[model samples]
Target: MSMADRIKTKLTERFHPLLLEVIDDSHRHHGHAGWQEGGETHFRVRIATRDFDGLSRVAQHRAVMSELDDELKERVHALNIEVIPADKA
Candidate 1:
């Protein structure tokens, strides 16, 4: 699967998100540091999941970060995540 697809799948499997939106924002960061020819360096993820129901914003982000693990350190240079509870959708 593609990098974006992989990212989406990983998040879905790990968090079972009720809503997930993975946006490739590499084009917006063109010419900036860490920008590459391919559009995989920057991403924005909007996810709503039961796992985030009782978590604070920082905790929600931390959960995602842990799920992303090495992908965040390697392929993903910039990531913006908007995490919310499933009911908030």
Candidate 2:
């Protein structure tokens, strides 16, 4: 599977998000640090989930980060996360 597909699948399985978008931002950051040739580096995630219903922004980010632990350490260079409650968006 592609990196974007893998990320979306993992987030869906883990959080059951109401909405999820995994953006491959590698091209935008070309020549920036950790810009790999394979385009699995920079990412921005917009996810709305009930799992984040009562969580603070930091807590929501932590939860998502934890779920993406392996990817964060290995393939991903940066993750810009937007965690929103399902009802808000």
Candidate lDDT scores, in order, read 0.87, 0.89
Instruction: Kindly list the per-residue Cα lDDT of model 1 for residues 18-54, writing each as its tens digit.
Output: 8999999999999998788987989999999997877
lDDT tens readout by residue for model 2, 7-87 = 899999999988899999999998999898878899999999987877889999999899889888888999999876799
Candidate 1 stretches with Cα past 4 Å from truth are none
RMSD in Å for all candidates: 1.0, 0.9
Off by over 4 Å in 2: none
Number of the top TM-score candidate:
2
Would you estimate the TM-scores of all the predictions? Answer: 0.93, 0.94
Please estimate how well model 2 matches the true structure, expressed as its whole-model Cα lDDT: 0.89
